[model samples]
Target: MISTVPHNVRGVAASCPQCTSSLGRIWHPDMRIPRGWALAAGLFYLLALAGPFVQISIFGRLQRADIATGPLQLTVQGFDLVGFLVLAVTIIFPGIKLGIVLLTLFGIRLEHQPTRFLKAIFRWYPLIGPWAMVDVYLLGFLVAYTRLTAMATVHLDLSLFALVGLMISMAALDGSLDTGAIWDALDTGPAPRPIDADHRGGHLIGCHCCFLINRAEPGMACTRCDTVLRDRKPDSIVRSWAFVIAAMALYIPANLYPVMLITQLARTTPFTIMGGIVELFAAGLWPLGLLVLLASIAIPLVKLLSMACMLIEAQRPSGRHLLGLTRTYRFVAFIGRWSMIDVFMVSILVALVRFGQFANVQASTGAACFAGVVVITMFAVESFDPRLMWDGAREAAPETPPDPTLIAEPA
Candidate 1:
């Protein structure tokens, strides 16, 4: 019994961002991605493959970029660490993931039966899908590098074009692929089973500590949490509080340390993530400033509070706004990763802006851990299933005649 959002709010009239449509195509059992996107992706990939993505003329001799050499340049520039991770997250993973997605799409293209490889790819889709961050990375990088490019002469190369292709392919794959629709295409089964009713009346069935849902019975052996059925709220609250404390500890270092460092011409300028937002604000770019603050600072803090609120709600289900708060919690968690803009800016700066003698910029040490923090909190958020908010409603689904004996139980 998931608390259904009002139909009015549930659908946002999701349209193609480029071409505004009041009504976006309904994602359905038989839906396939539009063909225009595939053509665009193919063209972009070919364009990216054409020639030197980057060109460097040192003392009159010129060098070019290929898939391998793009990262090699970063390695030589003392930004080997950031480059390696980008290689994995942006380049390698998007290629593999989109390849898998395109493979599935081609099955539809040819109207041929998909092979076992297609099935394996479909299964891996959930994990692979979220990692396609190259475009996001590209955006962040370009923003930061714009300031860097004014100081140097940098040339584009074959790998740069390939990177662009990678971005397009990823976008096309995302636009075309739909999980529910894909499952239908592959004959995958229905969504997971809903949680059973909470006999005790409180909506929460699972412990935050161990994800153990069913309440402990008289002699039932608990496989994960060995708690002896005393009070669910007390145990869960304590463990969740501990995690909150750990996140708090990490938050301090994540902010204080330079989130990214811009070094050029033997000079290093450190910009904490907060510092970057401050720069935006000082420049009077209010909208971008607001966007950054929300993404980087406000949202993460709100999410932390939302997680804390879950503990609060579990302990005292008396709150009237639990349903809305739970939804808000999920939304905050959903948007939390976009805070990686600062890190992405660092990558773009490193990749696009190359000035050997006068100036150059590279990401600092803290960016990785900060990325780790975002990812860690992301996993934590995912592990927490919001559907539990309505677990108690399962029993409430079929409204019964009021019984004088049954009083409304406190959450």
Candidate 2:
């Protein structure tokens, strides 16, 4: 029989004996607070998008842009992929995530059975939460604003303040959200299936997507969410290696090529990633320059190297430092996307600074390659399975040799 047992003293984790997988966390009872935060954030998000976000005055001409301006400008500039990425992360996913939170909270209040659609929405909450990058986008805006101030008189608008508030509210909502508590509130059915002691074949599999623990063969659909089940992520090592290697290859050209082309007074100048940072430092913006260096140059390299190490360790039989490796994998996954700050900065600049031949910002080939590196590294991190590290250790454990004293008596 499957039973819930605290995996930590703080009650943060519970393990399923059947699949040996973490089921959910045990959170405090104040889970309803995030619902209010989500609602406030949703309102702030609408306001942020509706008005002028930032105003720039170049040579006595004023230009204003809203939140949608970046993506639209990028698409018009022929960088459709990057445009869609910014839109999805900054606008689309945040709205969907906040709406889901509101809907799930409201659904709990209804004195009726929860529908499958509602359950599905709640299931996707954790998956979609990380992709909502408003906070990261705000950081990108800061970098862009710093750069713009050096060239033009930049004015922060009401929408900018609203966007800041929106980011803060979303952060608060995420902080207050209790995943385990939310799952418990949404579950209105029988307990998860237990692993039968007498069952044949392999161990019980847990659905990473839906948190359903069940006894089933690989490639079967999850009974609860219908997601295909796997003992581990399919071809985890191979896929991660492929993405990591590709990212590493792209990293070369991404750094060597100019990321942005600045046209000032009818003269064009190209700036590579480090070149931009050096220019920022030369202009006395040491802090922002340091930020860009860390986000653009350091973070990606660390992610690639760290992921490679984890993958190598996972594939080996050595039982050394499995816990540390698991923690490293989690950290790599969390920080992989922050490297997009430079990309977002480029987008904002391209959108705001356009005074044809007098002052303009254009994305260079390096921007596209760097974006590819960031995205591919993120996929590599996601494609990896931390559980494989532990599984390797378990499989590598030396079996206890048959006790000589307890050897069976001769029949």
- The Cα local distance difference test for each model comes to 0.55, 0.81
Q: Model 1 misses residue 201 by how many Å?
A: 24
Q: TM-scores, in order shown? A: 0.65, 0.88
Model 1 has an lDDT value of 0.55
- How far residue 207's Cα lies from its native spot in candidate 2, in Å, is 2.8
Kindly list the per-residue Cα lDDT of model 1 for residues 110-157, writing each as its tens digit. 556654456656556666656656666655544554454445455755
lDDT of 2 by residue, 1-411 (tens): 235433233435554432333444555547568878988998998998888889899899888888788889888888899888989988999999988988887787788847576777887787788888888898899888888988899988898888889989988988777765565566666875544444445567777776667668899987666678998899999999999999999999999999889898999999899998998899898898998999999999999999988888888858787666776777888887788898899889998999999899998889889999998998898899887876776788954422212111111
Which ranges in model 1 have alpha carbons more than 4 Å from their true place? 2-84, 108-117, 154-178, 188-246, 281-288, 352-357, 392-411
Instruction: Kindly give the stretch of ten consecutive residues in candidate 1 with the minimal lDDT sum.
Output: 402-411
Model 2 deviation from native, Cα RMSD in Å: 6.9
